[model samples]
Target: MAFSATARDSAVAEMNITPLVDVMLVLLVIFMVSAPLLTKTVDAALPQIVPPSLDTIKPLQMQLDVGDDGSYRLDGRLLTQSEVGERLAEAAISDPRAVLRVHASSGADYQQVVTALAEARNRGIANLSVQH
Candidate 1:
């Protein structure tokens, strides 16, 4: 271009907004096409939490230990089978809902442990369990 002095002055005074309008329209079309794609959602299965029930809550339990010498101990106190039965009966009488959790030593007699459990049951203990 060969522009006269008057034409140059006129062009300088008028703003050429074609590029601006074209850029704005291109941006609008790009956003219009990408808007829905960006708004797309994925389906997910979320885990739900459940409140604990009475059954789920562990009961208050007492420990019964069987020593290597076939001796019985309730709460670290040594006792004979009859004493164990007496203690268990007392505990059962105190709290019928409580559990008697028995733990036998690795070298303990299994039959004696079973006998202790039977004693607890004989004393009207309904909640008898063994611990690992």
Candidate 2:
């Protein structure tokens, strides 16, 4: 073989990726080991026993509908504004825990629906819902 002085002192231009690969593998393992610990759930003691009440009265559910012609109907029966108020008052008196659902027809006025809901609130109905 011929002796070449040019190759003796010149460094190789190739990159050494072994250390990079080793560092990446170490980081991957570290993350994998700590991931499960980061996801560990809190140990809590939630209440499992609930007491039953014998005198609990079931809440009454009533539906009120607003007609397309701006009329008010209670439980599918047509009624005037005063009558609706009276019926709501009666329901409130009979069962203050009554739930009222106000339904409005597609052609019904928004004011009518709002008025019905307001009336239910005035009658001391805390639970009320509006439907279409």
Candidate 3:
């Protein structure tokens, strides 16, 4: 039925925030110590070149088609895989900058297309492109 004001006033009045501040300072020191260790450096050398003349001759286009049956064609004319390499080599010999375009049927074997590309590379054909 009664309350004591003097008894309440005797209790602790200051908040204990020292532990929180200590933890924050420890975390800050740990970050500062490990910051340089977390950083990384990388170096790279890029290429430099002179632009080609605008009046250079345009390269001729050679089209290679691979059918679903694994058959090959050069410019719509059916040919064997060996014949394809021979034809590409012949074209390259005439014009070093000849361009090759490859087209493969949806059902065609992926290895066939790769083989065609490899053959062209072996024959020094650099300007190669593929058509879906």
Candidate 4:
């Protein structure tokens, strides 16, 4: 077979990279324009956060004790049955999250302990415990 010199001259073997260069230049311009916009900031006022007070941070705790002689004591202070109820109600109002722990003596009358517990429950004492 005879080779034709004209056919070889007409054929182009080089890779075309014009579209690739055009895309890279467009991407460079886009990134350059967006880089400054990314660093731009707007001035605005942010709300200040107030630290929590001691009262809210610490839970309120109270202890009630029933003596064997049918007497009630709150925080080591002797109080009447009606006064116990009043104190519990005040505590509930002062801090609804207050915790009450009832401690009964070994010989304490069951009825007295029950009465105290019932009063505490009625006063909205959600956190309560009875100890013997």
lDDT of 3 at 126: 95
Model 2 poorest 10 in a row by lDDT: 48-57
Please report how far candidate 3 places residue 18 from its true position, in Å: 67
**Candidate lDDT values, in order:** 0.87, 0.89, 0.90, 0.93
Kindly give the stretch of ten consecutive residues in candidate 1 with the minimal lDDT sum.
51-60
TM-score of 4: 0.58
Please report how far candidate 2 places residue 79 from its true position, in Å.
Answer: 0.4
Write out the backbone clash pairs for model 4.
Answer: none
**Each prediction's number of clashing residue pairs:** 0, 0, 0, 0
Candidate 2: list runs displaced more than 4 Å.
1-56
lDDT of 3 by residue, 24-109 (tens): 99999999999997896667787866567633668889889999999999999999988898998999899899999999999999
Give candidate 2's total backbone clashes: 0
| Candidate 4, lDDT over the whole model | 0.93
Model 1 clashing residue pairs (backbone): none
Report the C-alpha lDDT of model 4 over 1-132, residue by residue, as the tens digit: 998987886676567899999999999999999999999899999997776685368668999999999999999999999999999999999989889999999999999999999999998888998999
Cα deviation of 75 in candidate 2 (Å)? 0.7
Q: Tens digit of lDDT per residue, candidate 1, span 1-132?
A: 776899779878999899999999999999999999989999999997777685586656889999899998899999988888898888888777779889998999889988988998989789988964
- Give candidate 1's error at residue 36 in angstroms: 52
